[model samples]
Every structure is written in C-alpha cells, then in structure tokens.
Target chain A: MPNAFSRIEDLETTVVILSELAAAHEAEKALLARVACCRYSDAATFAIKLALEEGMNNAIKHGNKFDADKTVELVYDISEDRAIITITDQGCGFNPSAVPDPTVDENLEKPTGRGVMLMHAYMDEVAYNATGNQVRMVKRNT
Target chain B: MESSGDLVLDVRQQGSAIIVRLVGAVGMTEATLLGRQLDELVQQPGAVVVLDIEHLDFICSSGLGALINAQAKARPYEGQVRLARPCPLVMRLLETTRLTNLFDVYASVDEAVAG
Candidate 1:
C-alpha cells in the first residue's frame, strides 16, 4: 500500500508524545479503546493491540534510540471496517529490509527484531516510509 | 515482584522448578522486569522455570522476547523455561511466531512442574 496520509485524511486524530514506553502505552490504550468502540471482535482487537505495541516499541527504541528529547507521533482512525495507524519517530531511520527474519531457525531464539515481523503478520498491511522511521499499519475488522 | 501496571510476576519454588505466575499483560515496560526475574531464577544449577500464563491477557513481541531470553539463559545451566496454561491469544502468538517447538508447552501448572 502507498504511504499516503491523504488516504486517511479522515483520521485526523494525531498524538505527539515523548519517546518513552510509558507514554506510548497510554497512546496505545486510547487507540485500542477506539478499536473496541468500533465493535471489533475480540480476536481483531487483540491483533490490533499486538501490532500497535510492536510498532510503538520500534518507534521509541529503534527509531528514536530511546532519546528522551525526541518524540513519537501517532495518527490513527478507527471504523467498523478497519483500524489504520501510523507511527513516526524523530530520529534517523534505518533500513527495514536489513532486519533479519526472526522466524528462521538460527534467529528464532533471538530476543529482539521480531517487532516489525509480528506487526506485518498480525496487520493486514504494514508499510514504512523511505527513511524507515515511520510505519503505517492497518487491521481489517473481518 | 509486582509491577505497577500491566504485569505482575509471582515467583515461587515448586520442588526443583521455579514457577513464575504471570498475571496481566506483558508489554514493552513489563518485559524488562520479566527478563530480570527470569535471569535471577536461572542462576541456580539445573533450574527449571515454568511460566504460568493462565491470567496473562495480552503479550506483544517484546514479551515474547523476554521468554526467549529466559530460555537462552537457562540453556547454559541445563535449565529450561516451560510454558503452562496459556490463554488462546497467547497461544496464537506462540503459534504465529512459530515458537511452539522452541518451548515446551504444558496443559497445566502441575504438568509443567512435573515435566
């Protein structure tokens, strides 16, 4: 999918906060509440919640390198059909392609590097900007 | 030790196995605490760690990472981290990550402790 914010123009709710896990968690709670309010199934809510957590962790830890001074931006929209979320960090982005496949035999035991992979697995669509700092994920209600 | 939010870890010893009952969700913030707790438990010789996750409602990649870290730490001492009583969501996560074979999963706390 295209990384076009215009496509989700109706998703005007934007939240910008510090690069901290606590803050990101608050944002996640609020977004998940909206997903629930949209009447998504239990499984769909779980999937969205999981994907959101992984995306936020990547933005805060990998993208911003846990820089307290930096901030993470979250833009989201929830409807009966789908939930779309975009997370952007304020640090130099890395290459998403460079991340190893965590599902592989040798990498399965690795502790980290599974955030992006899980986001893709759970979400219907996952796309990153050219800089790889910003990620947009979508989950269909079905 | 219990965290302020999301996750609570209740650690107790059952025979040779150290059982950590995970209650609530384990997200990025809780994973650090989980990792530290597991690290300490696996220090014992031939430590067998059983994670009771019946009350665990949510877990993300970071939480899974903590479990993997514990398993890796336990391997050196011939220790192991086994999972027991995982909810459906957590089980789906394990299956999706293809980690079912990586960790021994039991149907109950008693079975895991005995195994």
Candidate 2:
C-alpha cells in the first residue's frame, strides 16, 4: 500500500463544488470515470473508482456528518504521470492516525477504517490536511 | 447492465438460511440500506447468511463494511456470513482489504447454504 502524497508541479486542475447531499456522489463518480476512461486501463479505472468512492463517502458521511447545509470541495487534477484528487469537507476534522488498523485480527470484523485502508492500498499516495477534514490521493499511471 | 445508481438487493430464504443476491453497485450511499437489510435477516436465531455476488458489479469498502458488520453481529446467534461468486473486481477488493480470509467463500450459493 502507498503512503503519503507530496507536493508536485506540472498539472491540469479542475475545481468542482458539490452539495452535502448523497446525490452529489454520482456526479463525483462520473467525473472520475471520465478521467479514468481517458487515461487508464480497466484495472486502474476500478481502483481509482473505488478510492474515489471511499474518499467521498468519508467526506459526506463521516467528515460532514451528513449535514445537508455543508458542502464538499473537490479539486480534480491529472498530471502526465498521475491523477490527483483532493476532497475537503466542512466539519470538524478527525485524526487519521486514530483510525484502527482493519487488517489486524481484532479489527478484521469491524466495519470502520476499511475505507481509509482501501484508499491507501489503491492510491500511490494518500495525505490528509492538518485538520483531517481534507484528503488528497494520487494514483500513478503505472 | 446494471448502472451504478441502481442497487438491487434481492433476498430470499431457504430453510434456516438467507440468500442475498446483490446486483449493481454497493457504495457508501447504499451501504446503510444494505446493512439494515442484513441486520434484519441476521437477527433470526442461527441464521446462515449467504451473499450471492454473481451479479454484483461493484462494491466499495463501505459496502464491504456492511458485510463484515453483519458477520460480527450474526456470530453471537450461532450464525455466519458467507460470500458466493464475487466478480473479479469485487474479489480483488476483498483481497486488498484482507477480508478474503475472514469469511468462508464458496463458488456458489448452494454450497454456502449447504455448509
């Protein structure tokens, strides 16, 4: 599984704003799918799609706590070698370190934390903003 | 082909076991509903829950969480959750999450229900 994402230069970025409604998830997925279809293989597309779903879900369900008044900020970008997705929620952030390891024996059956694990597994880089309300993931073309 | 927005969970009972046929995509949005359905079925004493994913095209980690939660909840009732015939994408997800070893997976629902 890949770990942290570092700042990089040279990119094509697009900004998107979505409501806190669950309906916004489909739009996010569709945008990701379009990017995947243009630049990635079938396997890569699946991984990216899964990562996007997990990240957006965390933002909507966990970060924003399903508060309809809030909004989700998404910055979608693609470089020559990788795709960068940054999602931010307008709620009190959480510490990613506090999340339990889902792979461990005691946590295997637990429902939580698996989404974060999958995001790390599929994306080459996963990073959180200081407050933890924002997550930036990068998937390498390779 | 089932679209991502459409998630159809068809549940049926055979003997003491319950079979859930999952179709389309199971993402975070649909996870709560799916979890609730699983919760209702697993509440029965000694219920064997079999998830038939032959038609399931996609499932996120949140969706996987629902399944694991059901498995945990059913354990106290002498019940178990089994997965049957997951598509390639779903199988890869299970492997990535290291959940493949946690549940008894069968090639078909019949084998899962029989066990």
Candidate 3:
C-alpha cells in the first residue's frame, strides 16, 4: 500500500453482485460517455469501450470470482494524449503472461479464451501489474 | 442506460445463408454463446450467413470476433456473411475496426435473409 496514490483522476467504484452478467455493460456506459465527451471519434470511443468492458469483465469473473463481498475497483483517467483504465480485484491473482495465445494455432477452437485477446487488440497498451490482480490499460486519446 | 436482450432468430431456406436477428447487447457472453450456434450453421452447404443487428444494443470486439469468426469459418465453403440493420453501437464497432467493408452490411433482416 502506498502512502498516496497520484496521477490518476481516480473514481473508486465497486461491483459486488454475483450475477456477473451486467458488469461490463454498466462500466462501459460510463467509459463510453467519457470517451465520447473527450472529443474522441466514434471509432476510438467504441474501441476503448470494447477494451475496457473486456478488462472489467475479466476482473469480476476471474479475479473476483462472483464473491459479493469482494469489490472491483475501476479507475478512469486521462493524461496528455492517452485514456487510462485501471481495474483492481481483491481476490488472489494469477500469472497474466501464462494465458494461452488465442491467435495462435490449436487454440482458436476454444470458446472462452478470447477476452484478453480482444482487450489487447482494441487498446493501445494492455499490461498486468502487482502480480496480475491489477490491470492497467490505455487507449490513444483521439 | 437501457439494456435488453431478447433475440429472435428467423431462419430462411436460402440454399445456404442463415440470418440471425440480434435484439440485445451482443457483448462477450452472448458472443461466446453465438459462436457455438454459428459454428453449427457453418457446416451446412455454401456456409453463408447474415446477421440482422437493427435491434442490437451493444457489441464489443468479442461480439465482433464472433461475427468475423463465423465469416472465416464459412469462407472455406465459398460462403460468406452479411450484416443488416446495425445499431449505432454495432456500426461504431465495425467502423472502428474497419470491418464495415469486410462484410456486406444491409439495413434490414429481410434484405439479409433475401440475400
């Protein structure tokens, strides 16, 4: 824990429901409006929204595991020419790099593995920090 | 602000193509589920399919990927996928990825079904 969190226009919100279905939709609306209001083109807004939804959904389902008591903190911020999204889960984290490559051969047939791939594709940068429980993603501010 | 997911899929005997009418947020979960259904449809002759998304609420890359994957699967059989009635969100996704040109998008399910 740091003494002070800086550089993030952070709004800490929690999703504590077990349904795990509408998490992305809820977060995406706010992100989309923010992106659109920032004078971003419709395409850029959609791309960022898509990427953020995937990241949040993963945080809730895999990172939080539908535990109602647990919370997923969503942070939205912008600096210079970049839009940043950070989602932190309170559950146990895993090896982010260990996930199989969905674009490679022998894995396309798998159905449940493309979320991270889509996040990487839509966002400018996708990286996991603090042992994979914290995902920090950015999309170019257009 | 409003989200709904009531999909009505009407199948037309178009020698090959099947049109799926989407009526909700075509997000990751539904996209994953649709992948299975579209997977089964691609095995048929000609392998072409059309998606009517006029009533679509939202679509992320996951949903877009499902559509692209369905199209790719159909291509081996000389079949293709078409789009119809893309809502604002759907259109945004397409235009963002520059996929609007990849598939033939129509304005209505009838057009897609007839195509």
Candidate 4:
C-alpha cells in the first residue's frame, strides 16, 4: 500500500475482453502504445510490454486452456508515473508458487517455465489472487 | 496505432549457416512458429543458425524460450545458434534472464556468419 498506487484512483481505467489469441495480441499492443505515450522510458515501456504479454498469454493459454468458449479480461490504468494491469480468465486458477524457476541449471533449457518469472522480473509488483485465477501487476516509472 | 501480433520469420541460407530474421512482436503463437522452423533447420547437416533480431519489435518469455530451445537443439550436432543485433529490449531481457552469456552474439549477421 504505497501512495503511488493510491494515485491510481485519479486515472481512468480501460477494460478489454477477448477469447482468441489474435485478439489478445492486438489488445496488448494497444495497451503498450498507451503506456509508451505516457512518456515512460524505452526500457520501462518494454518491461511493461513483456509483463503484459506474459500475463495475457497465461490467461488465454494456461488458464483458459485455449478454449474459445472462455474469455480473458484485462483491466489497465496508466498514468505519467506508473502503469497497473490486471488479467483474469474464466477457467480454473493455478498456484503461482508451483511454477518452476527457469534460471536453474536443469530448467534453463526449458521453453515454458519462464512466463511467471518474466512477469515478476519486469513488473514492480506482481500479485496473485487467493484463488490464483487473477493477477495484478504494477510498473512504476523511474 | 495499429497492432498486429504478427511475428514474421524470414529464413535464408548463407554458406552453411541458416539466417532467420524475426520481425514484429513475438508471443506464444509466434514462439510455436519459430520453434517449428528452428526444429527443421537444426536437423540440417552442419546447421549454423544465426537469428537476426534487428527488425524485431517485441519478444515475450516464450519467445525467449524458443531461441534458447533452438540453440540447444543445434548444439548436439556440432552446430550453433548465434544472435545478431538484438534490440535494447531483447538484450535487456536476455541479460535479466541470465542467458545472455550462453549464446554468442555478434554485431551483425555478416560477423556471425563469418565467425
């Protein structure tokens, strides 16, 4: 509960819903454009973009299991100093702690375990709901 | 701005090396595409693959994983995967993941192909 996020109350929020991977991609790119327009540095924008991609991919692929019947919800608010994004899927949730660290020797070559790690690494704060179905991430401008 | 989640891969053969130039943002869908293409290329005899990322706009975790997986696939055959001119964002990602040192990166494709 830092004051930085409390400032989120002042900014407008946008919500996007999608059931397909192609749609999710477009939504993510639009979100990134908004983030960049807020004047965040190149690195900060890239970090947010990466986190958003991973978050959306997880919601669509892992959570929904690529079921077209299920939909993913993305809510985001960006200000001059920070960006906050939350993604929720209609499928059963997962335990975030169960993800294996991709940096380890044995897991380093694996291709699928790095999404959660990248989200945590790029975003200033990454939090999962009690049921593990929803994730909220925050990135601040430095 | 228009957003297309398209990840384009342009492959060409230079001597014994296979050059794959990636363009646009890379996500889960594109990762699979890249992985499949790399699998085919790695099977070739003496496949020295060079990934050119100069035109790549963005790359997610799975995209990074695809690159590493491709590199791993080439190693057993005495072939290798080299990275050329990764943008600042991709470079930062590789550095953060601690996988930057695992691959040989060159300034350009000519340098990588020659090396």
Candidate 5:
C-alpha cells in the first residue's frame, strides 16, 4: 500500500493570506480557490471546501485571533493516489485532544467546533503535528 | 478567486444510474445547483444517482448539506445516491464531519454505475 502512494505533488505556489480581527474568510477563500483543481465528487468537493474553510476559520478566529501579522500557510500536495494537504498557522499551539464533539444533538447548531470533526469525517486521515500549529490531512485517490 | 460560484453540472446517464459530474467549487454558490439536479432526479423513480466530483477542488458545509438533502430525498423511493471519487481536500471535509460513512464512496463512475 505504501508503494502505491506517490511523493506529494507540490502546489504551484503556497497560498498565504493575512487577515485582521479574527476574520480569515479570505484565507478560506484562498484555500478553496487552490483546491479547485482536485478530482472529487460534488459532495467531496463540498466536504473539502468545508474542511479548508473550517481549518482556516479556526486558525484565524481561535488560534491567531485575527492578527494581521499572523499568517496562515496553505500547502497542497497532489499525487496520483492521494493529495496531502497541510494547514499551518503562526499562533501558539493548542490541544487537539481538547476539542468537543459536534455531532451531539445539543452541539448540532453550533457555528463551530465541528471543523476538526468534519475534516476527519471527510478526509481519509486527519492528524495534528508541531504541537497543534499544523494540521496535515490526506485524501486517497479512490 | 470565488471558489463557490460557477459550478458546471453535467448529467450522464448510465444503465440504471445517472452520473452527475460537477466541475469547479462546490461551495455555497454551487450548492443550489446540486439541489436543482437532485430535484430533477426526484421526479424520476428507480434510478440511482452517483455524484462525480473528481473535477471539483473545493467543498463547503453547505455543499455537503446539499448531498445529504439529496440522499434523504432519494431514500424514500428506494433509490440511493453515492459519491464518486472525491478529491483530497473534499475528503478532508467529509472526515471532519464524520460523514464518510453516511454515503457510499466509489472509486470510479464505472464502479458506481456497475453497482
């Protein structure tokens, strides 16, 4: 199975953005703009967009607190069997283990707290690296 | 770039299933396109629908909502809708929502069509 996976295909350029006051919608937009080249079903495309937006949204609002100087790094690695994408931020690391479950009935209407959950649900793998400053996710080529 | 606008929806009919191939972003803007397509299918009975999004790059919650909605609409008629070949980024969203198991994922349109 490992042999079937190929080296990460680097994106043409890193998509980086600086937002202010916890508004990272631009970053989310930028992230989505880059993912527009993926080979997925409409549902999957929506899932990826949601993940990217949610990731960027959390990075901006919760992590960096919307500091303009705090930039978000969006990297895309496209390959034949899979795409390895990573979202990194300059904010202080946090505890990924501390996130709450969003699927519970009471939490269903919450605007947030569901990004990580959703990411894990949609992607094949979702992992945290560098003490929570980075989120690396994988989507198989299936 | 607006990733949520201008999605191209193409429906290709195979034996007993319809392949709904979407190209571009499946964001808020294009979510409705999915709804419209599914609505058209709702009127037709007994045909499975497989959504093909390999050409799509980005997906949002609203977009996923549309799929869920379509699936729900199909359930009553004994017809099912499945997802075909989602991109990495798109897959990430499904995993995040824990919705990977909600819909059957296919490796290709042929596999889905054959099933």
Candidate 6:
C-alpha cells in the first residue's frame, strides 16, 4: 500500500487521545520535539507550531465538543524540507466554507472564529477531508 | 503572581496602568487562566491594562481571544488593554489577524504604560 506520508523521509508518528486539551498538549509537545530535531528555520518552526496548535485545538474542542468519549487522532511526518500533519476527530464534521470570515470588520472582535484563520495563515497548505472531520496542514521549510 | 502550567502572569501597578507580564506559552490550557485574570483586571474603574509580552514564548488564537475580550470589557469603562514588546512570532500573528489596529501596541512596557 502506498503511504500517504511517504514523501517525507521520517516515519510518520500517530497519536490518538481522548477529546481533552491536556492530552492534545502532550501530543503537541512530542510532535514539536520532532519538528525541532529536523532543524526547520525559526520562522518555519513558529508557523508550524501555531498551525499545529490551532489544528489540534479545533479537533478536540470544535469537532469533538470536548466529549470525553470522543477521540482526536493526529498523524505527522516531519523532514528537513517540510512538516505534514493531519488531525481528525470522532464527531460530525462541519463545512469549512461555512465559517464566517474573521477578518471582516464586524467579526474582527469575535474571538472564537480566528483559530481556522490562523491555521490558514500560518500553514503553507491546509485541506480538509470531504466530511470536514479531518484537516491536513503542511508547512514547508523556508 | 500566578502560574498555570507553562504560563506565568505577574501583575503590577505602574502609575494608573496595571501591567501584566506574561511568560511562557499561552495555548488552549493557559488561555482560560489568562482570560479570567484579564477579565478581573478590566473591571477596575478606568483600568488601563498593559500586557508585557516580551518573554511570552507562544500564544494561540484562544489567547488572542482573551485579549480581545479584555479590550471589549474595558471599553465601556473608558479602560483599555495595551500590548507591549511582542516577539516576532506574536507580531506576525497580530499583523495577520489585523489586530495591530485594534489594540494599542508599543515597543516597551513603559511606552505602553504611558500610551
């Protein structure tokens, strides 16, 4: 079977955790360590860190609604050239296009909607599965 | 001074402004604590809250939300929240979110206190 993350040299790391912010934090720490080991530029590291945080937060909070029974899955491949990550949740997904633009004048003050915007801004590429339960973000070393 | 996991908050008074120095990361877990603390600070009469972020290593959207919420809460009271010494990473986020115009930003905590 062809691996989805075969392009990156490193073996992909997969993590599954209950829909808890604490567990997500742990997963993030481990993944960030891997990113650091790859020696990505400081700017690239910052971008990846911000996007990863937003992606995991959305999966655990918005997607799973913090339901203890629900789980969030994270998969990542980190190489010197780029880092690719996917976060999936065990809840009904919503359309990304339906999210209101946070940059709009009226919505700028609203805080909750900026997560998705930040993910898009910091990542080189962001794509969601058809069901919207999974998000894949890529940050290329620059 | 208050600490929650990776985030530390040190609040001090500088003239009429209340300066809160944040250190470490402010992700999802730390945002709750930051929001609550900012809420309490903004409730003071004519409060001027200055955030010293020189040492803040990281912040996510939730943390930005907390800042916006504090600013909103202070508006009715003729109070405001000012940001000081944002690191490069944080500056990029402020610029990306177009929040640079929404909040008064300064190069130093002293400037924020005076502004």
DockQ: which candidate is best? 6
Write candidate 1's Cα lDDT for A1-142 as tens digits. 5656576685668999998888998998899888878999888888899989998898898889889889999999888888989999988898888989988889998866788888888899999999888898889988
Candidate of highest TM-score: 6
lDDT of 6 by residue, A38-120 (tens): 99987888888889889888888889999998999999988888888999998798799898888888888986679998898
CAPRI verdict (incorrect, acceptable, medium, high) for model 3: acceptable
**lDDT (tens digit, per residue) of candidate 1 on B7-115:** 9889998987888999999899988888888888987779999999999999888888888888888888899899999999889889889899799999999999998
Which rank order by lDDT, best down to worst?
6, 1, 4, 2, 3, 5
Please identify model 1 stretches exceeding 4 Å from their true place: A1-7
Error of model 6, residue B113, in angstroms = 1.3
Q: Between which residue pairs do clashes occur in model 4?
A: none
Fnat for every candidate: 0.81, 0.81, 0.16, 0.72, 0.25, 0.75
Candidate 1 clashes between residue pairs 3 or more apart in a chain or in different chains: none
Instruction: Give the winner by lDDT.
Output: 6
State how far residue A15 of model 5 sits from its true place (Å). 18
* lDDT tens readout by residue for model 6, B32-71: 9999999999997799999999999789998999999999
TM-score of each: 0.94, 0.85, 0.65, 0.88, 0.51, 0.96
Per-residue alpha-carbon lDDT of candidate 2 for residues A26-116, written as tens digits (9 for 90 to 100): 5566566667556786677777788888888888889888786887877776654678888888979999999999998888887789889
Can you list the residue pairs that collide in candidate 2?
none
What are the runs in model 3 whose C-alpha is more than 4 Å off? A1-7, A10-19, A78-80, B1-3, B6-16, B23-25, B32-48, B52-58, B61-115
| Model 6: residues with Cα > 4 Å off, grouped in runs | A1-10
- Provide DockQ values for all models, in the order shown: 0.82, 0.69, 0.24, 0.68, 0.13, 0.83
List clash counts for every candidate, in order: 0, 0, 1, 0, 36, 0
Query: How would you class the docking of model 2?
Result: medium
Encode model 5's per-residue lDDT on B1-115: one tens digit a residue. Answer: 1223457778777887888888876654466677777867855676699889798776666567677777777777877888889887666556656666667788898887776
What lDDT does the true structure give each of the candidates? 0.88, 0.80, 0.68, 0.83, 0.68, 0.90
